[model samples]
Target: MTLPSAMTFLLGGLLLAGSVLSKENPAELAVPRDTTGKSQWVANHYKRMMALADKSPEKFRIVFVGDSITKKWLDDSGSLWADNFGSEDSPFYALNLGVPGDRTDHVLYRLKAKEDGGLGNLDNPAIQPEVIVLMIGTNNLFPPHDAEQIAGGIGAVAKRLKDLRPDSKLIICSVIPSNSAQKDEELVIPANATLSALAESMGDDVRYLDLFSPFLDGQGKKNTECYEDGLHLNEKGYEVWFSELMPMLKETLGLATEN
Candidate 1:
């Protein structure tokens, strides 16, 4: 066939294939809806579990739950959390249930299943988590989503946590400081604002802690050694986390504040 004729034939075939593909994947054609609520549902659920722990007597088993930052703290080959809290022999066991690349939506599902003891399952009704440390909203800062939506999603997750475990203590940690200078920092600020606001709105039942300030040097930017990347914390960073967090734990659990 001539070059022009062959080109025309190929175009016709491509169009037919495209039509078939579209029908097979209707989702591609559908308009995307806002995921703010969906994301917040997970946050709500986490908060429920944290609230449930507050009523527990004796030791309060705590779980730090979030994305890569939370996961790294748990996966410490040296057992950073365990060492900081003493050990399994300590007053309370700190369970690391942080999953990598997880958004608020992922956490909501995990809580229902009790896959990591963050949220104990119905079958194993014996286990009850006393506290939950929640820090999320990094990924939601991308385009097409605003900070309010991200906050709403996180709020929903907090609600769910409270509902599932009404007695647990809910501690909402500020998102660790971020240093990306791109996009005029608007993307970063809104999400953090939303998270901080949500944490405050929970009242005394849910407490909020901000660690962003300590992680910084004289500069407003993040301390270089505190984080491996501009996002996640390093050992020095976790050290800062532990220093600030240990006191909160003692106070929340009614341990002796005097050191």
Candidate 2:
């Protein structure tokens, strides 16, 4: 009643081939290259959106614009720098316009669109910001542009802001120290310098504030534990920022700290 030896061997080989085929898959099927390309396209499109907001005004009193560092300020306590600035008790309307990994070019586009055409459209009645706190250049550091070029771009944004807003006060902040152990000091130092100079060049209406020293040791390296990574700050880091920013806030707004 048993099958022949050759037949039995043939059946076993077929089963083994089936198992092997089940375990294997074509590389193209596992990782579609199209996904990566699509993601890149989405990111580029997203970057284009701020231009629309720029030309429109919802009438902000104070607006903060930059990359993740600026966005992180929002995550800080209700008592953080943002709170200390524009408040209902105060007349200034504070707005945060930070996009993670955004460069100065994005800020420029937003300003142009908002001031020139977008929300400020006569029918819409956009609120022009009276004070702008700007921090950028970190994202630009990791990619195609170097620190100097990034700083130059910031300078251009500053000039445009002055031209468009005229009366608006500008505060240009130094790039906060990252919590990195290795310390890309070369990039960090130059980028900070460029931004500071550009801020100073704006004359009376603009002021440059450097908070890097407080975050770093004498060696000029980041206090990584101060940040979630070496790049972004945490509670303690925000506290340090709040302290440095207080006097400026007081003088700019002409208010004494509350008891």
Model 2 — TM-score against the truth? 0.68
**What overall lDDT goes with each candidate model?**
0.63, 0.63
- Clash count, candidate 2: 17
Give the root-mean-square deviation of each candidate in angstroms: 11.8, 16.3
| TM value for model 1 | 0.68
**TM-score per candidate, chains pooled:** 0.68, 0.68
User: In candidate 2, what are the lDDT values of residues 142-233, reduced to their tens digit?
Assistant: 55355566567667766766776677788888877654333346566776787777777668779988877778766766666567665787
Q: Model 1, 80-179: lDDT tens per residue?
A: 6666542556755665556555666556656555554434422234445577777765645443245555556567667777777778788877656665
Q: After superposition, how far is residue 118 of candidate 1 from its true place, in Å?
A: 14
Report the error of model 1 at residue 161, Å.
0.7
Model 2, global lDDT: 0.63
Off by over 4 Å in 2: 1-59, 76-87, 114-125, 179-183, 257-259
Stretches of candidate 1 off by over 4 Å are 1-60, 76-79, 113-123, 142-144
